[model samples]
Target: MLKGLVIVCANGCFSSMTEANSKVKALLAGRKARQCCELLVLESALGKGGAPWDFQRGSDFSNVDPFAFIVLA
Candidate 1:
């Protein structure tokens, strides 16, 4: 089966990580994008220690597009 992947950006300059997370969900639900199994956040959003937010919730999101993640940088 073909899985999907999405590159979500969160510079934290204009948008917050939470907003970026919302955007990622939007992209997954977007019609143009493919079936995303993973959602990678930019380095700026995820700090070195990965403090701030827990993107782990996305793992069980809908489960319609396979698995997902917010890879720690």
Candidate 2:
């Protein structure tokens, strides 16, 4: 069973978070309580090892883009 939804944004931007949150909420509208899951947002630096997964060398997130997030359920 899904208990939560996590949004991991590459850059910590308020606008990005807000947009993602709204999208998630819209998607969950009209769902039953049990079907709906808690939402969480996390800020990370993808090229700086902020994420647990490994990335290839030379990857650049120097200028992190807006609204770049990974959804985990």
Candidate 3:
């Protein structure tokens, strides 16, 4: 099985880690993918150096497609 911690972040921002994790889990609750991946949230506001608020700034996905599929080793 492909089990890993899927760290999710918003194009905007989330206030807390708990809130981010819960919201993502709730959104994916009905999906089978949720069963294999452990959901996590990147608390941009609390991280070191912080994260960019604008999606176009300091973001790798700024010019990419709307969806992404990542696998962690």
Per-model TM-score, in order, reads 0.34, 0.42, 0.40
Question: Which sections of candidate 1 miss by over 4 Å?
Answer: 1-10, 30-35, 45-73
Model 2 residue 52 CA deviation in Å: 11
Distance from true location, Cα of 8 in model 2, Å: 0.9
Q: Write candidate 1's Cα lDDT for 2-71 as tens digits.
A: 3644453433432456666666676568654445355555424342333333456446465332222344
- List the candidates ranked by TM-score, beginning with the highest: 2, 3, 1
Sequence-dependent TM-score of model 1: 0.34
Error of 1 at 47 (Å): 14
Weakest 10 consecutive residues of candidate 1 by summed lDDT: 64-73
Error of 2 at 28 (Å): 1.3
Count of clashes, each model: 4, 0, 0
Q: CA lDDT of each candidate?
A: 0.46, 0.57, 0.52
As for lDDT, the candidate ahead, 1 or 2, is 2
